[model samples]
Target: MTGARTPCINPRCRRTFKADGGSDEVVCGKCFRTLAEAVRSEHRRYWREIRKWDRRILRTADNLKVTRMAAIRDRLSWQLALHWDAEIKPRLIAPDKPESLDAFLEEVGL
Candidate 1:
């Protein structure tokens, strides 16, 4: 089967690239591979940790009410989203603040 396509993780060009699905890495036809690989590596690492935390949370929350578990999940998700935006996103953007700050936050449902 064909793989999914996504934009290169480059702020300047943001050219599209085909992701091989086997790996969560994206590299545009252009030589934005370095930056893309770096981004993918970091995201993979972060998501691994997130998964661990999420599973632990789920297990611990088994005895809690659904509402309480949901609230806890929401809090953790938003905090991680904020960190991704403030820490990881700013590096690619030229200015400290991205062109569409509110738009980004809105996407994360923050």
Candidate 2:
């Protein structure tokens, strides 16, 4: 009954640490800040990737109408949803995106 392990977020460290809230699991606010910074740093790229996925889905709309491809489309959409939840959504906006990412967008006049 071992718990989960997460990689140490220190940029200079290569070790993994337990992250499952065990009694001995030490928490690190610095790592949390680091993770958030990394996510925010790529906000624009994340949006671009999400838009690309949208266009790809639209292009495949006709194939989805073919009945047999319906299953494949469903599977793809499910996978996409998982990706969105796990990767894409967290980096786009606050309380998701950090202030720096939003400021970056503003600077670009977006």
- Provide the overall lDDT of each model, using Cα atoms, as 2-decimal numbers: 0.58, 0.51
Lowest lDDT sum, 10 consecutive residues, model 2, at 88-97
Q: In candidate 1, what are the lDDT values of residues 40-72, reduced to their tens digit?
A: 566556567667666766667455664565666
Instruction: Tally clashes: model 2.
Output: 1
lDDT of 2 by residue, 4-106 (tens): 7765434344556766575332224454454455553454344565566555656675654545445555555666556545654443222333469778898
- Inter-residue clash pairs, candidate 2: 93-97
Model 1 stretches with alpha carbons more than 4 Å out: 1-4, 12-49, 57-67, 95-110
lDDT of 1: 0.58
Off by over 4 Å in 2: 1-65, 93-110
TM-scores, all candidates, are: 0.40, 0.27
